[model samples]
Target chain A: MLIDDNDIDLKINGKIVAFTKTFEDIVVCRSGEEALNYLKQHLTTPERLPEFILLDIQMPEMSGFEFLDHYKKLPVSFTEGCNIAMLSSTLDFSDIQRAEANPYVVKLLKKPLIPAVLQEVVKEHLQR
Target chain B: MDTPSVKVLYIDDEEHNLQAFKASFRRQYEIYTATSAAAGLLILQNIDINVIIADQKMPETTGVQFFKSIKDTYPDPVRILLTGYTDIEALADAINHGDVYRYITKPWSDLELHNSIKNAYDAYKAKIDLRNKVSELEKTNDELNRFIYSISHELRAPLVSVIGIVNLVKMEGLYNSSGEYWNLIEICSNKLDFYIQKTLQYYKNNKNVAEHSPVEFEILVSELISLYSYSDRDTQFNVKINQPVGFYNDAFRIEVILGNLINNAIKYQKSTEPNKFVNIDIDVDVQRAEITISDNGIGILNDHLEKIFNQFFKSKNHHGSGLGLFIVKEALTRINGKIEVTSDLAIGTTFKITIPNGKAT
Candidate 1:
């Protein structure tokens, strides 16, 4: 699943991820608010939940951090074994540090997520 | 304290006093006089009086009374009271009760009165200058913050797009049968290059002074047309110059302004249609030169027209570096020129540029 507010980034990122053909199914949510709404609908049938969720850091109403605050409170089984990654254009060191500090977040990558960055992360995670 | 055509108004009951005041300061200021306080009030309402000098005693009204009366209606001009009366108590009362800026004793030395008015005008100007500077700072601060955010987005967004596309080409077997998406990668790379060039131009515009020289309008137009015409062969440029000779201005800045507008004309052309054309018209005289460029391309939306010149304002549903019109505006600023744009979506966008003739006004 890919969640981002920028329409260009959303469309381009989706195409990039789909070309990789790693994930069987891909879902995109525009905002953290809508992403939570999506998660709520899938709670009863947790199988529908995305295995790997790529969330954009900067959004209108709810940022990636604000979304995690709510995401962590959900029952463990709904998010169990599901991996979350943060995507941002900011190169600010503190932004990286703050995103890394999040326990639910498994990966933090700078934006325009090229295939190499994603493949490396996938490789590292699959090895573990 | 350089005199800067400061408008000075003197009001005294005695005709001799008013004449004497005007005579002394006529060369230094735009001086006006009234024989009575009532007549001075009339002049105040008529003009943008910068500094008002009223004798303390008048047949119709006291200087302080006149100042107090005009306080609300004519408040901008600094008020000075002139008096022969040596009553310190009265002067103190006028200073406290009236909004009298300063009181000058009568049988005045010309030097004393001149210095007093100069100081009052200086103080008045300082307050105005401070307010303007504060607002200008606020505007610059806002632009700086926006520029920081946009630089990150504009700089990174394209590179990521390119990388993502290149990866797809390698992984998706895009080179095989119908690799049309390869063209997209090419377009993406070009867009990135275009933005990089524009960013550098924007930086250079802010840093350097433009070199001025003779600018032949038709020659510049043809050069720009050839430069852009390479990409889109179908696009046509119709150039017209009413006065091309002896027309001199800052060539580099004009190029910057014209280049950006003409580029937009080419870029926004309706790809599906066969008829793609840009019309350039230049009307010049001794005072100012007006250049109009119109395009029958996929025009800008009505809502986006007002904000096109704003820094980093990209019209929704449009893809660009969003600095084209802004750079045009900045370059125009340096040359004391102005641009007017009118566009109708699905029809066209027309830009009319008026630049001062010789040296930048």
Candidate 2:
């Protein structure tokens, strides 16, 4: 799943991941609110949840950090199976430090997503 | 032209002396006379006095003591001490610690008194002006720092996205078949990123204070060389260092100086030259490091060499934002370093830099 406000970023990152052939299907939400809603809808059915989610740091409403705050409240079954990583164009040190410190975030990757990095994250997740 | 009257305050214990003093300078200045230190405090609160003249032999407080007491509250007013006795110790103490502008003896000459008051007023105005200028500079620096932070983020976001899209296109093998537009996009994106990086370097050079750290030139030069190695240009880097002793200076500033000069060397390489190269030579001692970076590229003209260090001074056929060399010059100044450049058209350019050790002995 890709969560970002920029349409071009979502499309390109989605295409890049698709080319890697790692996931069967990709889900994209334009805002953190919409992404949270999707998670809530799929809370009962863990199988419907995405295996890996690439979240963008900057958004118009409810930024990526805020999304993580709301995400932690959901049942462990939903968050445990899914690996979340923050992808951002932000060059700020504080943003990088906070993302690294967040328990829910697996990695903080700079934009735009490279296919090899996405594959490696998935591989690392399966190994764990 | 008529000049505005300088507001003056004369404080004395005796009534006749205050009257005599005001009678002498009432036409030249707007004189406010107080017969006691307590009354003088009252007048200061009510009016904006430019100069204050106090009698040193008052009953409650000497002139130096009075000046010291009001130094904190009424610091802007220029203070002058008036005394009948020539007590050198008290006068020296007043001038050194009490912020006394000047001390005038009793039976004051009108001409001498007038000159002292005029000079005191001028000093007061200069102090205020200096403070205003300093505050204005701080405001500008703050605005510049904020502007750089926002502009770099705002401009680089979309620019990065475009590069990502380009990367995606290349991975799909679509760019190679229809490579013209893709190559153009790639070139334009790289150029934009380059300029943004240069601007950030300029800001960092101005904002950060130089730090003294032990620098290994071999590692520093190798890292910089690897950075430029990613470029498709065929220019080679030849480095030779003779640093037997420890060298300490601001490593970040040294990087700026070396990075800009090397970047310029690679950037201005003659496209047709098959064997182009940049030579970096460093001779280091405990006191200083002398470095020379030379390149066999499309060399700068004599006329352009002098103006190249000026901010935003772009020569003909210049590919950069013209900030590279200017940042190098500024970084040198901060580190107490010096640079000398010599270039010939179609021959080559060399920059010689001498950076002193910043570590305190």
Candidate 3:
């Protein structure tokens, strides 16, 4: 799943389309609130549940951090088969440390995410 | 913002003396005349006078006593005494106790009167100008504080978004078999990472003051070329550094300025063109060292060249926050260095920086 508050620019979306060619399914959400709503309704029925969510840090009403706060309260089943990765365009040390400290957060990815970074992520976590 | 002329208040008990004084200096100054000490004070309440010249003998009060009363209220104005021969002792007391500028005896010359007034006026003007400058600086300082606050808040918002995405990917093992899905996550992550690094560099550049040291020009240029050479391999861009013999300059500031220029040159270098390159030339003289960086890339337009050093000002085609040149300019200014730029669209851009060779005192 690809999630960001900004309507992803054409350059970024083009990159995303090329990336999703190998996946069986692709889902997108505009904000943290919409992503949470989608997950809550679909997780119980097994109709659609994303394996990983590419979450953006900034959003209206519910930010990425606020979404995580709410996500922590949901039943274990909601996240039983899911992983969360933060995707942002920021280099603030405090923000990186804060994300790393959260139990649910898996990794921090920089924007304009390219193929080399995907390979690194797979080598570190999925291959095992 | 034109300030009003300095006001002068002259007090004397004799009506003819008051009229004579006003008639003599009225055209040259903003003059207020009073016949008694009480009337002189009432005039002071209405006008912001710079000088107070009082006759030593008045009907109800001595000149020294009246000056002492108004000293706190008009501390900046130079006080002077107009005394007859009989009041010479009182003039001395006013000079010692009340801090009078000078005493004019009875039957004073017009030239002497004019000279004293001019001196007092010049001193008053200096005080006002200094006060104005200090207040203006305080206003600018307040504005800088506001800018820092907004910059911090804007930076924090994007950081939170990146963290949220990382958590979602970890639990599901979503891209286990999907190479394309993995690529999407990677691209997002890399862009975020680049932004974070650049932002941190910007913040650090603002806060960090580079320690001054003498730097060898040839060695520093070679090191900078090597640092950027690897990144330019795919584009196959050529970089050349030419340094004169025995050339040395302020090392820390030079490193920062060169780093930003080289980075910008590489960033704007067009991918389609082969044989793209950047060149650095260093010339040392007795007084100053001149370093120039020239690049054949997408050059800036005429309008943007003037404002390129302003904070957060970027070209429309560029992707970064537009802070690199601004930081470079600020760092150079701190070291008493100067920079000049020339560019032609589709041709190239060149930046020439001149730094003093000797150690700064």
Q: Using DockQ as the measure, which candidate wins?
A: 2
Runs in model 3 lying further than 4 Å from the true structure: A1-128, B1-143, B146-211, B216-232, B235-252, B284-286, B302-304, B310-313
TM-score per candidate, chains pooled: 0.41, 0.76, 0.44
Give the RMSD in angstroms, all C-alphas superposed, for model 1: 17.4
Top model number, lDDT: 2
Per-model B-chain TM-score:
0.53, 0.78, 0.53
Candidate 3 or 2, higher lDDT: 2
**Ranked by TM-score, top first:** 2, 3, 1
TM-score of 3: 0.44
Tens-place lDDT per residue, model 2, B1-361, is: 1987789999999999988988888888999999888999999999999999999999988888889999999999999999998999999989888999888998788888889999999999999899999999999988989799779878988998999989988898889777498999999998998888787787778888888888889999988988876784488788999999888988888988998888888888888889999999999988899999998888888888789999999977866798999999999999999999998877789999999966643
Per-candidate interface C-alpha RMSD? Answer: 3.8, 1.2, 9.3
The digit string of per-residue lDDT tens for model 1 on B7-53 reads: 99998889988788888898888999988878888898798888999
Among the numbered candidates, top TM-score falls to: 2
Q: In terms of docking quality, how is candidate 3 classified? A: incorrect
Model 1 pairs whose backbones collide:
B83-B106
